[model samples]
Target: MPVMNPMQEPCSIMAQPPFRSFLVPGQPVSHPDHPEWGEGVVQSAVGHRVTVMFPHAGKVVVNATVVHLTELS
Candidate 1:
């Protein structure tokens, strides 16, 4: 007798999961110009503008295209 493989779950047939390319609210991030601001949590992201709240620098809006904010783990 030959052994049979188990069936795949429904989720396994779905397309690839969402890529983490876009930053969402509450996600931690940092900038190059003001590293002193430390890690900031994203408040909102619209088009090329992103608003984040920093621990020392408070809230600030940054142009996403101009600054490449590093995503924090």
Candidate 2:
């Protein structure tokens, strides 16, 4: 049997309503779970994963579905 690439597979979560509020690159964000990390800027947003650059925590990858990152105005 051929193996299916997960990336190519359709993500059901992406179709959900809350998924519409995904963040984009360069957007400022803050992680409530890790407030000590301070505010961070979104470096990349792919699928359900987001890479954020935090001053204290450095680059961290978080699950968009679970994290619910706060967008900084």
Candidate 3:
């Protein structure tokens, strides 16, 4: 069996109805697990990886599967 790279596969977030509705570029999000990182703007989302630009942490790549980022208005 060949190992499937997440980056090569279609984003699962986009396939799921609920997650697809909200996960978009430029969306405001906050990490619940890492509150100290502060609020961040969604830079990009691909496959299972989401790039978020945080005030204190700069650009950080988070695994969407493990971290449920809260979308803020």
Model 3, total clashes = 0
Better of 2 and 3 by TM-score: 2
* Per-residue C-alpha lDDT of model 2 across residues 10-72, encoded as one tens digit per residue: 568688654443799999999988899999999999888899999999999999878899999
- In model 1, which range of ten residues has the least summed lDDT? 12-21
Q: List the residue pairs that clash in candidate 1.
A: none
Q: Which structure is stronger by lDDT: 1 or 3?
A: 1
The TM-score ranking, best first, is: 2, 1, 3
Q: How would you encode candidate 3's per-residue C-alpha lDDT over 1-73 as one tens digit per residue?
A: 6788877865685775543334788999999978898889999888778999999899999888788899999
* Range of the 10 consecutive residues with the lowest summed lDDT in candidate 3: 13-22
Q: TM-score for each prediction?
A: 0.68, 0.71, 0.67
Tell me the deviation in Å of residue 56 in model 1: 0.7
TM-score computed on alpha carbons, candidate 2: 0.71
Residue-wise C-alpha lDDT for candidate 1, range 6-70, written one tens digit per residue: 77455554776532337899999998889999989999987778899999999999888778899
What C-alpha lDDT values do all the predictions have? 0.85, 0.89, 0.84
Q: TM-score for model 3?
A: 0.67
Report the Cα lDDT for residue 25, model 1.
97
On lDDT, the candidate that comes out on top is 2
Residue 48 accuracy (lDDT) in model 1: 73
